[model samples]
Target: MLSEFKAFVMRGNVLDLAIAVIIGGAFATITKSLTDDVIMPVVGWLFGGFDFSSYFIRLGPIPESYAGSPTNYAALKEAGVPLFGYGEFITVTINFLILAFIIFLLVRYANKAMARFEKDEAPAADPADVVLLREIRDELKAQRGGQ
Candidate 1:
């Protein structure tokens, strides 16, 4: 059972999937940072605010013990405030789009590369016996013509 498990884990597809997952996680983090740190800030500035993720509508009343500012979305949420955080959603959506676009481009190029490799392959050579037989047949035809 242990050997079977080891064999299953050591399969090429499984190893490839594991590596893809790790790479995908890192890529996702990069996409998230790009969305939050770069794009959102510019978008927020255009919308007349410096912080885009803080643009939320308060749904429920703040707790009596809560001392956070009313405009602080993260702080209010931490203090058990209900919020319609549309800015954060927008950021996440943009991140997903970026990641999906990158993956699509990668897959498209990879398929093109694979197709090129397949098309460039030379046809298989004939076996030694087949080559020898063809040579003998040509020699016999030549001898018959000469006679």
Candidate 2:
């Protein structure tokens, strides 16, 4: 059973999948940073400088001990305030779209590259023994036909 498990884990596909998962996680972090730190801020600036992440509707009253800014979504959420965090959702959605598009492009290019490799490969030449055998067979056929 242990050997079987090891074999399964050691498969080419399994190793490839593991590597893809690791790369995908790192890529997701990059995409998140791009969305949160770059794109969102630019979009906010374009839309009159209102931060999208802070655009949440408060669903419940703030806690008495909550000393943070009332309009702060992260602080309010951390303090157990109920919120309809649509801005955060929008940011996450955008992040997902960006990640998905990047992965799609990678897969598309990878497929194209693979296709090119496959198409460019010529068929293997016949072995020396096979070529000799074919020549002998052709000679035999010629002799028989002549006879």
Candidate 3:
């Protein structure tokens, strides 16, 4: 049973998947930073300093004990207030679009590079027997033409 388990863990697909998971986690962080630090600021500035992350509607009244700002989504949520956070949703949507586009570009570039690399490699030659047979057949045809 231990050997079976070891075999399962050592499989090529399993190792590939493990590496993919690690890389994907790292990629997620990069995309998150790109969305939060770079893209969001520019988008917000373009839309007259609109910040979608801050947009939310409190569905319930805030508790008297709650000291956080009423308009703050994170604070309201932490205070146990029910809220509709549409602005935050929009921000996430934009982030997803950006991440998807970046992945698409990477995949496109990789495919083009692979195609060019494949084109540069010469094709394999026919087997020796096949080549000899073809030569003999061509010679027979030539003899027939001369006859």
Location of the lowest summed lDDT over 10 successive residues in candidate 3: 91-100
The whole-model lDDT of each prediction reads 0.90, 0.93, 0.90
With candidate 3 superimposed using the best TM-score fit, by how many Å does residue 125's alpha carbon deviate from the native? Answer: 7.6
Off by over 4 Å in 2: 124-147
Of the two candidates 1 and 2, the one with more favorable TM-score, higher being better, is 2
**Error at 123, model 2, angstroms:** 2.8
lDDT of 3 by residue, 31-87 (tens): 889988998899889999888889988789999999878878898989899999999
Ranking by TM-score: 2, 3, 1
TM-score of 1: 0.77
Report the C-alpha lDDT of model 1 over 22-138, residue by residue, as the tens digit: 999999999899888888878778978867577799999999999878998889989989999997787788899989998999999999999989988967789999999999999
Q: In terms of TM-score, which candidate is strongest?
A: 2
What's each prediction's TM-score? 0.77, 0.83, 0.80
Per-residue lDDT of 66 in model 1: 90
lDDT by residue (1-147, candidate 2, tens digit) is 999999999999999999999998999999999998999889888989967788899999998999999988999999999999998898899999999998899999999999999988968899999999999999999999999
